[model samples]
Each structure stands twice: as structure tokens, then as C-alpha cells.
Target: MKKKIFLVSTAAALFLVACGINSGISSEQIGLRKASLENENKVVLADINYSAAQPGEASVYDRSYENAPPLIPHSTEDLLPITKDNNSCLSCHDKAIATDVGATPIPPTHYYDFRHNKSMGDVISDTRFNCTQCHVPQSDAKPIVGNTFKADFTNKDLLKKSNLIDVINEGVK
Candidate 1:
């Protein structure tokens, strides 16, 4: 029994040593970037060019996936820093005024509170006030990693619009 254990241990050690000697990977080859992990100076990001078109002039892009936050089609240069006191986005995107200005209205989900599960009645829920948390302006920068994902919308209307409120509890027990 002792001889069998000794031979098994010896074979396992030899196999591990052989693997280390034959297939050792360097630090540079460990990551997808194929660059030295210690060097930040060597890493260069692709140039990001956001939309320069003003609101109502830029074209809306199809949703990346079902219930995905729609990207800001126009430049947000002058409408940033959404504070509690001032949210420039509401000037155009508020439900009451959005249609008049040809801007997409803040969805019904924004008016309903998920935590308390009640309607706020004409007020944007505090949780949904920060539009940029989920939504971002579109950029022309190339992706660092390749993706082959294609969004499969159940219906054509879901391609551009979100029905998160309608389907939020679809599978929940």
C-alpha cells in the first residue's frame, strides 16, 4: 500500500513539473491585452468621439438589447452635472413637455417607485432622477474586445422603445 502511494505521488509531481517546464506562460501573455501588467504608459485607449449634434437634430439609435437604457443621441456637453436643484435633461425630457419639444418622454417606469411600489404622480422618482447612471452618450470609439451579440427583440416596437415596467415582474414568483 505504501509503495503504491509513493509511486502515485512521484508520478503526480513529475506530471506537474513537466507541465510547468513545457507550457509556462509569461505575465504579458496572461491577459487579453497582451501587454505588461506593470506598465500603464504602454496602454493607450482608442479615441472617443461623442455625437456633436444638438438635441432633436441627432438620430436615435436602436436599443442595444431588450430593456437597455437608450443612448443619448445628442451631445450632452452643456447639460451635464445633473444636480438635485437642476436637471437640464428634464427641460426637454420631462413627460409633460417631451412631446411638445419632439424629445423622447421619460418612461412611465421613471414615474413609478419600485422600492415602495407606488406612483409618484407627475414627479420623477428619486431613484430614476439620475439619467446618466444607466444612459450614456454614444461614442464612436472601437471596442477593445470583440462581441458577436445580436439583440433579439420579441416585437419590432421593442427595438426602439423599452417596456421594462410591463415585463419587470414577468418571471418573478
Candidate 2:
């Protein structure tokens, strides 16, 4: 038993030593850019410039992708801290009032309780009540690192060929 343990320990040590501590590769060879915060004494934070609420034709903003959370096209200056008794968003976004206010009503899915397997009547389900969890107001702040991401359906021809609603509801009965 002692000989088996000794041989196992020796083999493990030899394997680790053979792998060596360093690959001897420079940072530049792997194309690693310097971190944005490396030179900053204080933590570098982006200066968020909140966009003002735009009415009428100016209110529209293209969604990042089909079924992606639509960016809040208007300002959320003093309209936050959504509470049990006081949700400021419901004043305009509630299904009953949205059409009158010319605001988009919260989707039917928001009222559907997936866990309960039933449609919640009139009110936004508890799970979906906090709108900010999935939605964010757009800001004119530049990212510390550049984004190179491209949406899969950016091409107009490709987008036209696919029915987004059908794709989104593919598995639902």
C-alpha cells in the first residue's frame, strides 16, 4: 500500500514538473490589450448621459434583436424604485391605459405566470413586475472596451425571410 502511494505521488510530481511553470509566451504574441483600468488611480466609471423622453416620431429606437428587451426610449429620471404599492411605470404602461397614453403596453407574456401555468388577470405577474430586471434605459455612454458583436439577423433579406413571432413561439402550445 505504501509503495503504491509513493509511486502515485512520484508520478504526479514528475507530470507537473514536465508541464513546467511557464509557456514562455509574451503578452503581445497572444494579442492581449492592456486593461482600461490599469493606469487609473481611482476606478474608471463611465459618465452616463441619460437620454430625455422623446414624444411622437422621435420616440422610436431599434431593438438589438427580435424579442430582445426593448431599450427604454424615454427618460427614467425620477421614475424608479418600483414598489409593491407604487409602480410609476404602470401609470402609462398598464394595458388598460397604454393605448390612451400612446405608450406600448406590457406584453401578454408578462401577465402569464409560467410557474403556475396560467394567465394572470389584468396585472403584471409578480415575477415580471420589476421592469428594470430585463429592460434598461439607453444612455450616451461609451464602453471602456469596444464591442465587436454583430446581431445574427442584421441583414434585411435574412430578417425578411424569418417570422420572428413564429420563431419566438415555436415550442409553446
> Best candidate, lDDT-wise?
1
Using all chains and alpha carbons, the TM-scores for the candidates as numbered come to 0.79, 0.65
lDDT of 2 by residue, 79-127 (tens): 8888888888888889898889788777777777878878898968999
Tell me the tens digit of each residue's lDDT in model 1 across 1-173.
99999999999999999997789776678777777788867766667799999999999999999989999999999899999899999999999999999999999999998889899999999998999999999789777689999989999998889999899999999
Estimate the lDDT of model 2: 0.71
Looking at model 2, residue 165 earns an lDDT score of 31
Each model's number of backbone clashes? 0, 0
**RMSD to truth, every model:** 3.3, 5.9
Q: Score candidate 1 by lDDT.
A: 0.91
Residue 169 displacement in candidate 1 (angstroms): 2.5
Model 1: lowest-lDDT 10 consecutive positions: 39-48
Off by over 4 Å in 2: 1-41, 54-58, 153-173
In order, the Cα lDDT scores of the candidates are: 0.91, 0.71
